[model samples]
Target: MGFTTRPELRGTFGAVSSTHWLASAVGMSILEKGHTAFDAAVAAGFVLQVVEPHLNGPGGEVPIIVTPAGADEPIVISGQGPSPAKATIAYFRKLGLDIIPGTGLLPACVPGAFGAWLTLLRDHGSAELEEVLAPAIHYAENGHPLVPRIANTIATMRELFTTHWPSSADVYLPNGEAPEAGKLFRNPQIAALYGRILEEAKTAPSREARINAALDFWYRGPVAERIEEFCATESVWDVSGRHHKGLLTADDMAAFKPEIEKPVSVAYGEYQVFKCGAWSQGPVLLQMLQLLADTEIARLDPLSPDFVHLAVESAKLAMADREAWYGDSPEVPLGTLLSSSYAAERRALIGETASMEVRPGSPDGRRPILPPLMEVGTIPQPGLGGGEPTVARDRQLPNDSQGEPSLNKEGAQRGDTCQVSAVDRWGNMVSATPSGGWLQSSPVIPGLGFSLTTRGQMFWLEEGLNSSLKPRVRPRTTLTPSTVHRGGVPYLAFGTPGGDQQDQWQLLMLLRHIHGGMNLQEAIDAPAFHTDHLPSSFWPREISFGSVTLEARFPGETVEELRRRGHVVTVGDPWSEGRLSAVAREMDRGSQIIKAGANPRGMQGYAVAR
Candidate 1:
């Protein structure tokens, strides 16, 4: 890591880092105004929807990890709503499909972002709802610079929108062309929608009442009405080359609200790693830590092949378990899986050479159940590439884009998300990963100014699996946010936006930061790699056993050495893989100070501290 672009900033007041700059600034402004960390995170999350629409939308879901100052234990705010009451595996098969297609309205779930953000703010925020959402409304209504990648993303789907989703064309192609890079871009309709919500919210008697009013407006009122109406009357083509109608209903929207639950955590070394439960794919990271609990990870060289090998192998094992045992089920034997005894038994499986096989272990005598079959017929890319807008095309491995796949995985293949982490003076910390509802994924709901999420695509048609689709159950989603406490104090709030690779990339940075003695920026700047060995949770699931992709920046000698170790390697450009960002808070003397770091790979992520 020669000369990182920025330092791991250390400051006395507060810090915020996100996948985009303006979002970070908005959050920082909120913090500066004496608002809670929850308010800053919510403010930033909405800004992300306006700025990175190609990656996430108001229609997406978030699994947030919150560690309020003075709280004894961190909690997970389940922003990911459950599947529609009609989103049954039987319904998809009835439409002549074995897997839910990656794109189109048929696979959508109730929009969850609004409800979740509001929940966080209602319980934790110190500012008015309008104050927290003001930045996003301003940008979306007036105008903001169009990121070149977003322009390119829209260009890829230009044809599809023109042909099948004219409502989308009306918004994205307002001038009959994809908006040019860095040009002033505006979505007045979305701004107006935000304004209307705020106006309605202000009429309520109290802050909580205002939030509830806005929630009702979005979930059970006009927004839901438009979504249900559009979905009922229209059908869109999916990756399977067929069209299907949406299964979501306004009742489904009205029935769902964000839930608060205890985080699933494990005490690893001096830190306790906290992540959202299995309802999201968060516990996979905790499970990985459980397996590595006894390993001498802190003694290894961060860039050494030996270190990378162990991490990769451990991830393969844990992710295999994720496929087998992890899901949205309350019946999961999480206690047994995270036990030291289980780690000992599972640790025995890591051999010297790479294992191409997908291995899932038994915990407490329960056999792991896998998807009936991981579908093929399409090669999955790292980002969204299966959609018509961001068609599948190999670029570079460390690319920032999660292309919209016309044919790909629903969880990781066809979708991507946005991430935010913020810590304010009062000791409140939050890490949120909001994603889904790519512009190319579904036709825009007329008058609503946004589309619903295609999160239902993550559900499997097969039964008896932990992630199997059922009415009113959340999909085993890939959106995961994380919090880490050092020496029994909340120390760090961090996360990224890659689909299945979220934890993989995070593991690399974390191992470097905690084990190898590297600072935040230095650890993030270090070369990263991930294995696609497990069956993907996305639609048209694909597995790449014994496969490894490395950033080309890794030492040539080290790269060659790994290939000789029997790993199938694909070398990618340096600075391409992850968009990891983080903010840390700690006690200095008697006052708490904050530090921040962000990924430079995408040229999009930013960290602000003051």
Candidate 2:
């Protein structure tokens, strides 16, 4: 095996991998306390909200794929919240808007992360409510070392905070300035909030009842009241260059509940890979795998031009289908889309040269209908308030000429999503991608210390489409997590933090591990690449035809060959591409063993096992 940035952790006890080292440590601590993986993941998920606030927070969402010990299959905890009852295409059109702005109150949805964590703990976890929340409360009240990316994100939004969002300034800029990198930062409001919830929850009689009490407090009690009051009273400035009040209400919060559903799975070799339903972009990975099922993926060099070309082409095709078909509505023909025959037909489109056109297949003879496509370069360069902080090749702004913000000198964007995976000795496992409610996403609600999710921005303004704007319907979220079962048992759980690149990066890692025989660490450490050829899920949606960005670590010959084959190649900084982490379980000689690995990029992700 090639040299990896870190060793792939091996153990018989437990394993945890997460985008932030602090969260990973917290998860390991939970496991040491004799709790199940579900409990550990819930604790770690809350800690991620505290430690990686730029990437996620209490007001965000998380879609979790979990398989309990001896369970038949994995289940999905859908934490993604739906749009407000008042959010409608007519309302936005009346405001002279064709697309939802990426940031601010107008796009706020029902904050679902907190409720989802509560649901997971109530149903599958064994830990007490206060026990799991204590770590996050302690970190929020005292202090945690500020990551440079968080500091930089604050600095970028400093002017906007001070000018238009004083409530946000009060929490993020306590000393009238952006907190310095490596300095300790605290959000006492978050600490106080959770503390109060625990106080209220302790009045309950039993453990499960306490968890439900906490849920009620968040969705129907003081937290919901505050969110509703703020949204109704304040009109905040956003990326749309106007001030708008949010449509979310306390009733919306009261009516919301996280759904636990079965996952969608596809056979890949001897493994069954499972992902969240079409409400997210999870199916894209399954689609890509099916397209490559009959190819020569196992024989090709994982880093050669052939491998890269094959993966990028399959991604483009799957992403095209995502644009045309994926949504939270019942109209999605998911069965036809995931069938082997459809994949075989799609695979025949791969040629010697790259294809530039956006092509969606006719699944089961139903003609695909796509939303209006925006021309390249039509969207303006994003201001500090733009959602979905992007990783790009150049340090200069507008690197892609399609409105994607370039990387800063620190080699990190302002904020994105986060991933966490955990496996315990009891054989339970979880893979969750938590995202939205970025500090830049909206003004901090008064007294809440957190902002609402702008995930509703993913909805298209056009009607008669699967992803069109609709009240009480989920936006097609980009956050996706993966769980793989080997021969009917839980095997691996993994995910990453990019908006559109989440599935793309995971597909590369899985392909290399399954076909190239690389271990998790080596697969994660390999050079990463993704295509910008599909319409983006973020606001100011843009498309770049035939564009592929690769880390500079890829072979120069491979890069030149891709360009020769008609890809618009852009080389990124050596370690700028992926933030993947994974954990797996297997039996060896009648004993169970666990293994883990994390991305070395960003100097943050870590895997811990013992």
Candidate 3:
């Protein structure tokens, strides 16, 4: 590959990477202002909600992996919310559906991002809640440059907004027209709501107390009241064949709270990788690592056909297990599944040729019930399940309301979700993926200025499975962020925002870093590849066997060699895939220096230091 135009950003005090440059700047400014890493991360997260509304919102969820200074083990903070009390398989089946709609009110969960971020800030941060939130408020009340894709999404969905979701139309399509790209876009209603919350916080004597009060207001007070009232009354057309009311209520919102728990860790030689529990797909990385443990991957070229085949084959087995054995509930045998011995058995399945069969392991000596077998050739289409679009460039962006798609949709559009990675001089490090609740996900609540996450779309309506849809249960979410530590010291924070492809992209970067001896940006900028052999986690759950997508930068002989190995190969433009970003720390001059890098694809992700 040619030299990367975006070099690794190195600094002494801190480093930050996020989906938007403005968000990254705001975060670094917080760190430069003497705030803690936790404070910077929360500030950047809130800014991302304001600047990347097409990707994420306050109504969305975030899963965070955090490693504070001197801590031996990283912790997983679940910003992911649960389904409402009324979100039951029976209810969805009663609506004449076998699965929940991928977009709209019926799949709505309690908004968890605000409470989750506040919980982190109040507990670990020295900054006041108002200070952390001020940047988002400013951008929301005033304006920020609208990214081109968000402008295009608004234009395509304008009629749907104006006719079916007028409350949303009032907020997004001002005066009945899409906001032009690069124009200052403002959502003052959201600003006013947050302004009121901050004013209420002023009555509290302590900073921690003020942050707690804001959380209460968001979950049980006026904000929740407005959400409850709106969802109870309004119905909107979605990917479902018909319109439907929401299942979420104020009581559900009030009952919800983010949890801080231990992360599941996997060891690979000197490095220790940490990820969230079965509640997320984070552990998929661990499972993948274990499966590849015995492979002589180091002997193969990083861009060789052999290395690509091993990665894709391992991903197929691990992702199939994700479908059958992973979920928020404890019914999953995640412990046994992650064992090296179990991996030995599963790893043996990596044959010379690609297999179309979807197979999950029966860990703990019990049979695992798998989801319906999708035919391998059934390639997933964008928005097939009426899902929010993902980071994959191969898929089309938002289509217009009249069913007349964009005539200008010639080029492949880049991706989704908001991600922030921050590490400060004090040894504080965090990796977070905030997603769901896109503008197209649901009708906006009239006064709240955001929509509820449709994460429930990830759960199956089938009976007797780990991820079966149930009232008040957290859905198995795809939003995963990762942190790595070496010998009790935080070392790396890295993540991407692709849906099912998130872990896939991260794994490629990781192997290149460890096995190829490349630094952070070198690993990230290397050409990446992924397989569609397993069923997609998004709606429609489609499958495509032996289908591998590779950056065209790879040698032509290597590409053809993969096809000769019984793989179906497709070529993507160089640097066109993987919106991944990363931050790392190392000792320099008797002190630690921070380094960060963001993806250059689509010109959206930004990284900065010094």
Candidate 4:
């Protein structure tokens, strides 16, 4: 694999899949315009929406963790749109509509990304929206090179796009086909939208007024109405207004607010661990670290048999806890899961050798363990004749006449997400995993320039489980944005997108670097393993360790040892679809060195630190 790593020369560092050049140019623009870390991230996110709309958009929810200098409290922003006030648990059950799919308006969460950007700018930004958004506006109006990856993805998904969204096809496919690599791609419609925001910002008297104006432009005025009209015509709108109002009415859009809450923190050895709440999978990272800390990992040779065995064992234990206990805290004991006693108890289970079978435990609960949701007794008819019922469960392979499982079946499609990280000149670090659920419905909306997320597809219709995606309920998501700190200072900012494999990939990288004493890039470059045993977004336990290697890297004895431990292991593609982006900074006394790492699996990312 031709892997590349570079030092970010400017004060800021950023990476986006498929367009490192575009990301770098935008980051430079933010710095040249004198924006803070938060401001630049918000700016970069907006631009990425225009360029990489397949992953996220201005209409999406954005979860952010920001640490500022000299401040005891880190600024945490929750860019989540709420379930419409009318939405209730009873609503989904009544319609017999419970399966979660990655399409339609079902997964829309009040479009928190824009709200988050507005919040960041209102509080901490040095420049106005016009200056921060100038790069994206310019790119949209003029154009940027159409990279091969983007062009190919567009071509591959074209049929789905044309079938589901005629309007989206009009813009993305300019000449009966997706644009080719190096072709200058432009969106005059999105450019016009940006122009409107700027024009409104100029007329506003106060900063808050200007921000509100931009928010209103998208949420309340012509834009909001257009969204509603599309949903209504498509008949995707729930007429009862029981679930979140379709396409957001003026009231729904106007009433939406961004949440700022203190991050849940735990002591992972000497360093304090912080993460976005259980509404996301952020807490899993901390749990994995804490579990590893309780083990004698530092005593073992870095890649020796003894070390890899313990590391994998520790990871499984931690993942078990995550599967059971990590979820939305509003209805669950989120804080309790992060408690010291909880971490210690979970950690105490790791053994130097391996345990064959993974012990299944129920999640900590206020209620007795609820049975898995009832299987659909009958297949309800789709509201639209052409569409099918959106079921979130992994489809099982059919059984043969002899009652053995058949391998001819395939899985449902999921969307790709973007993760970015940066370490500034003064050593302030920021990491964000902003993603959209698979672009279930393509050509999402005309002139919108992107697809709507099928995030709703991640939820279940079941009554009691953590994976339940009821009305007004947030589904269990894998978008975890994390920062690792050592000795009371930020050290690493990293995140990845691989559905359920995200946590496993990140956990291994952290241990390799921190406990195994490898450099940042080395940790990322090292061969890694992921399991499919647990309830990740997908199924059949995708054990990727052996699937990637043609040559035997581990000793035959080590492979035998792992088998004795009961892993249904497979050597996997080293550059499996999982893509992790990271920027690590080592600071001693007054000096600091920052190193960035990008997976070699994809060609469109880079790392730079001055």
Candidate 5:
């Protein structure tokens, strides 16, 4: 759960709120500016940097997967930066530092989320950076109401926020206290930063230069110098005077470059799965879908007890694999795990009987068992099945022509991340997930809208692990932005920022809507079950089974049945559930039905649509 819930906006366009009001405001502004969904999403990311500074900023990194309408090749963007040549395993070994517990500026990676936006502009946007960034600029200058979620998170982590950066304490802790919700929060410093970007863009001839100028201001220019000077005097980087690289230098800031990459996609029945490469846990999501396809899930009823049971079981299985083999592929053969043959073999292991025992199995390829479709009540369509029949559309993205395998998966963490989805009248769509790691780990630069990331905490300190934080190695991440298409047209835009929980939440939503035929809200609202069948990024060895929790919601007998299968069961409270925000578009007849949902777990979320 990163930011706020999904806001409902009508107009054939929608935006899900993040933790920051400025992020939402910027999202709405992007829509007003006539940018596509992707453009607005990128703008939201930029704006969120200002309002929610501790999580992520212009200098932060993000990994992405984007699929355009009617296009076969899915565009992948890696917002990650290479490890500085100064970093090495030996470098840490000499300092006797094996693990850095989730905090400190030294752990910041080269920020690439800004670069990811540039990639989107090159491939998808038509507007200039100023237009895309107008909303954030306005909010930064004019100020916005501090929503409940932002206020709460700030209050909860006030110590961390103030301790990380003195400027953050000055801004977030106005009046020497965290403001309550509905209070007018203002940040003229961030506003000035935006004003500068807009002023520079007016004269900047090339789109690239305009975007670069904005980015440069955050890093190598005045911002970077201020941050360096502040850290030098504040003593924030002193880890007992060892492993202190002081503040991120101007050279580090100037050297940051985002990467454009080809995404890895795999077919699963009538639909296809697309994911960011090994640089993130995105591949784990697709692989889970592949394993699920081998089961009887695709054919199951949307809301039946059996359907829920099987889906939960399949999720646990997929999580198992994710925990085992997913990581930075640059140093390993992570892409081989996605081969069709490998998926088929894993599918064969799905036992009809429920089993508590779950393990990451050996890789094998085999054709999957055809699953049975469930009989759920549905409105009859013209010349379709009588009952509430499933809407099975025939559309699939073509595989990459070249056999170059997908690589790269490294660190990602959830501090405060939000996603936005928009679809204009022209059938253009956007899916974007903007993130900031936890507040205790990093600080927002003075007057900047966004914060530098604490992404380094997402990596493991243990050697021989996929998520291990090696010197000069990027970490695998879990921030994923996804788009779903039907009838060769973009229909759904969704993303989540729940750390490792992100993929599971997204997969459940996709499966329920695409295969199970649940409405957007229903899919998001359904009770969730997580699996610890694999190695969790945080936990070395653990697998959570949905059967255990599903049974808790139901009769005691169901739990008994799951227990018989050998699952370790632990029941949790109904409150404090994970949050999910998603937007979807469906065409019924000639009109469009645009729907969005925010997780019920939070108090602040609004969906505005006309």
Candidate 6:
């Protein structure tokens, strides 16, 4: 009802929303071609790897939540690749390193994005492999306009590329300089690589066989051979201030395959929210909902300090549980953690004032154990080569005090992920968060035109813990996507791009929509906030006790009120917080309808419907 950045799109056909306008258009185009939502999402996902190279690439990973039309429940496509067999805690300790470097070859994992997309296309989609990949190849071969952030990220990493990673320099630093913003940029090497794969796939006799052939080319054939050769021979500079060879191998790639599993769901009133398993931070959102279920969340004004305090406090508890228990291993007691009784025990910790301590609750009488915390001033800052790609904060901190890597003296600019959501006329829906292998995260592989993912940096060096560095195990990732079913029918698919802030922002939007009666655009457009009270999932793993960052659009009185409640509040520029996008489907008078919304921040996200 109030002013929105744009209208919440509504139609009787299909809807698509993504972090990039070009990707959204690509998804819309696939829908126009009469393909399924799975096809549209696969096409748009590949396009994002080309257009938003600073955020994601073919070498990264993605976690997708999908519900086919008339399906009983949503399924999670676990695209997160595991660590190499050689990436053990002993191996890192032998190298005299206490933590994995945030950049370079040493932290490289088996790139899973390509295989994951192929799997989605092979199993659920109705489009051909060539059709699904044409948009991405066209953009990569010809050119696409560079967003300002991509240009800025390249400019920031220019010295590192030119001086150390020449393969990266050859691809990114065209004409020995960073490409200007809004200018056309191309990566013909990636285009040629996909073209070769398509050609190889064409040798197959059937559509499914073609997709499987492409998968083999990427994981067991030439692509894996190239990556293995490079890692075995080349030593590259990284955030450790030293050159190191990677541990990944052709066997690691060959051994890995994306798995489709059931999603974890929790009931909230009439809605059943679903998220990926504990391998991701998705369940934290479910935990937050459980923590708030007993409170007066529906009666409180979403913009008031009361609502903000409750939300942030609940996030702190849930995120603490995430740090203590969530991982890729079977030891994660996710069921008890999401139990209503456990939520009640955790909810009892909230008071009239904020709590500064990091607290993890006991599940089923099990004593919680956490990874060793990194003390302040202990994390190394080896310049722009480290850290995720994000916006630079306005405030300045001393070099020794920085947690994540910063591009300049101003502050840390960490852009970690990208998101896409699609819903077709038949009610098929998909939500995916694709991230890692950022241009700044690692050196580009020669001739591949894309970099390896440094997701291994999320693992701690300590032994015996769930997130400890281990051979052939997944590092608990921060990339999470969400979906919801109203009255046991798939109704919504949504997600965002912030590393730790993904679930936090989504919590606010969901609370506002379900309780405050706000539409999708209104929920997204509302002032966003998040707590940094838990240890970060990224490199250098810093924790800021009682810290809360809010958009300046929040009222001044509310800011003061939060400070009064003992929250260490930092107000950021208006529209600087979230990049969430969502698409939904429902029936109106027995006629199917599609609805969509996208974040207005960064002027990049778009929603299309018809």
lDDT leader: 2
* Candidate 4 off by > 4 Å: 1-19, 85-90, 94-98, 236-248, 300-323, 348-414, 437-443, 465-467, 470-473, 538-560, 584-592
Q: Taking the tens digit of each residue's C-alpha lDDT, what string does model 3 give over 472-578? A: 88888888898887665788999987777788888988888888987778888888877777655655555677788888788998898898888988787776557
The segments of candidate 6 whose C-alpha lies over 4 angstroms from its true place after superposition are 375-413
lDDT of 6 by residue, 1-610 (tens): 9999999999999999999999999999999999989999999999999999878999999999989999989898989999999998888999889878778888888888887888888899999999989999999999999998788778877777877888899999999989999989999999999999999999799999999999999999999999999999999877667789999999999999998899998999999999999988899999999999999888998778998999999999998899889988999999999999999999999998999888999898888888766544555565444442322221223211122333442334444588999999888999999987888878899889999998888898887678888889888888889999999899999999887888999999999889888888999999888888887776667777788888888899999999999999988777877789999888889999899999888889999998
What is the TM-score of each predicted model, taking all chains together? 0.95, 0.96, 0.94, 0.82, 0.78, 0.96
lDDT, candidate 4, 207-311, per-residue tens: 778887888887777666666565545534221222332433455666666778787766666666667777777777766666666567767764455666666
CA lDDT for candidate 6: 0.87
The residue ranges of model 1 lying beyond 4 angstroms of the native Cα positions read 372-415
lDDT of each: 0.81, 0.87, 0.81, 0.57, 0.55, 0.87
lDDT of candidate 1 over 332-420, digit per residue (tens): 88888778789889999988888877888898888788875442335543232344333231222334443234311221222367889
Candidate 5 per-residue C-alpha lDDT over 538-563 given as tens digits, one digit per residue, 9 for 90 to 100: 21112233333331334455555555
Pick by TM-score: 4 or 6, better one: 6
> In order, what is each prediction's RMSD in angstroms?
3.1, 2.9, 3.7, 6.2, 12.6, 2.8
Model 3 is weakest, by summed lDDT over 10 consecutive residues, at 398-407
Predicted candidate 2 versus true structure: per-residue lDDT over 1-610, tens digit per residue: 7689999899999999999999999999999999988998899999999999888899999999988998889899999999999999999999999988888898888999988888989999999999899999999999999988788878877777888889999999987989999989999999999999999989899999999999999999999999999999999887766789999999999999998899998999899999999999999999999999999987998779999999999999999999999999999999989999999999999998999999999887888888777656765644545342322223122222221222333443445889999999989999999987888778888777898898898899998879999999999999999999998889999999988889999999998898888899999999888888888787667777898888888899999999999998988778878789999999999899999999888899999998
- Candidate 2's TM-score: 0.96
The collision pairs in model 3 are 391-415
List clash counts for every candidate, in order.
20, 0, 1, 23, 56, 5
